[model samples]
Target chain A: DVKVTQSSRYLVKRTGEKVFLECVQDMDHENMFWYRQDPGLGLRLIYFSYDVKMKEKGDIPEGYSVSREKKERFSLILESASTNQTSMYLCASSLTGTSGYNEQFFGPGTRLTVL
Target chain B: AQSVAQPEDQVNVAEGNPLTVKCTYSVSGNPYLFWYVQYPNRGLQFLLKYITGDNLVKGSYGFEAEFNKSQTSFHLKKPSALVSDSALYFCAVRDTGTGGFKTIFGAGTRLFVKA
Candidate 1:
C-alpha cells in the first residue's frame, strides 16, 4: 500500500523556537506538498516540491519554508514558531504525469501547538 | 487558476439515512476534481476523484460523487450514513490543461451523523 508518513503526530513548541515537520512517502511520487489546516479556513497550502531540491510557494507560504533534499522526504520548517502558527499540518505526495494526472495521498498529519 | 467551493459549512443527518455534500468548482478548462474526508486529529484521506468518462465515481467507505459538467458541480453522496462516516469533507480542484497540478481545496463541510 502507498504510505505517507509524518515524523510527528503531535508537537508542542514555545514561541520563537524553531520547529521541523517531516514527511516521507514510500510511493516515490515526484510531487510533495505541505499544508496547514484550520477550522473554517480549511487546508491552506504552504509549500510544495515537484522534484528533488525544487520547491514552490503555495497560497499561504508566509512564515513557512520547505526543503526537499531527497525525493521521498519533504520538510516544513518554521523558522520561529509563533502562537498563531498552531495548527494541523498535512503532507501529501503525488506522481508526475499527464495521461490521467496524479492524486495526492496525505499523511496522518501533525498537530502543532505553539504556546 | 482553479478554485473550489463548499458552500455549506455543516451538514446534519441521521444515521442510516442518505446524505449529500455539495461542491462546485471553477477552472479555465477541464478540471480534475477530488473529494477527501478528514477525521478528527487525522489527516485528509482520498475518497474519490473524477478525471473523465463516467460522471459517477465510487470511492472508499461506500462514498460516491457525481460530476456534472453543465452545472459545474461535484456532489458527494452515500447511501447510508454511519457514525463513523461523520467527518470534515473537502472538495478540491486542479487544472490539468496548462498549469502544474497544484490543488486548491474548498473551505470544507463538517458532516454530523447522529443516531
Candidate 2:
C-alpha cells in the first residue's frame, strides 16, 4: 500500500509569519501536489511538482510557494500567513505515465489556523 | 479548461438504503473522471475512476460510478448505505486528450448516513 505523510496535523501561526508544511510519499511517485481545502470551495491546488527541482502553479498559487529538493519530500511555504490562509492543507502524489489517469494517494491533511 | 461539478451540497440517507452522489463534468476533450471520499480530519481517498471501456466502473467499499458521455456525468452510487460511509465526497476530472497533469475537483458533497 502507498502511504503519504504530512509533517504537522495541526498548526497555528500569527499574521505575517512564515509557515512551512511538509509532505512525504513512500511510493516514489514522480508527481506531488499541494492543495488548500475550504468549505464551499473544495480543494484548490496551490502548487505541484512533477519532478525534483520542478514546480508549477495551480489555480490559486498566490502567497504560496513550493520546494521539491528531493523526490520523497515536497514542502509548501506560506510567504506570510494571513487569516485568509487558514484552512486544511492536503498533499497528494501519483506515478508518472503516458496517460494522466493515475490514482493519487493523499496524506492525512494539515489544518492550519492563522491568527 | 476542464471542470467538475457536484450538484448536491449534502445527501442524507438511512442505513440499508441506496445512496447516490451526483457529479457532472465539462471538458473540451476526453475526460478522465474520478471519485474520492474523505473522512473527518483526513485527506481524500481514491474511490474509483473512469478512463475508458466500461461505462459502469466498480470501486472500493462497494462504491461505483457510471459515466454518461452524452450527459457528461459520472455519478457515484452504492447498493446500500452504512453509517461508516458518512463522509465528504468529491468528483474530479482531467482532460486526457489535452495532455496536462492538472486535475480539477468539484466543490464536494457531504454524505450523512443515519442508523
> Candidate 2, what DockQ?
0.77
What are the TM-scores, per candidate, against the unseen true structure?
0.95, 0.97
Indicate the docking level reached by candidate 1.
medium
Ten-residue stretch with the least lDDT total in model 1 chain A: A95-104
Largest lDDT belongs to which candidate? 2
TM-score of the candidate numbered 2? 0.97
Q: Which residue segments of model 1 deviate by more than 4 Å?
A: A98-100, B96-98
Clashing pairs in 2: none
Per-residue lDDT of A5-85 in model 1, one digit per residue for the tens? 999999999999999999999988999999998889988989988889999888889999999999999999999999999
lDDT of 2 at A112: 97
Cα lDDT listed for each candidate: 0.91, 0.92
- Residue B39 displacement in candidate 1 (angstroms): 1.7
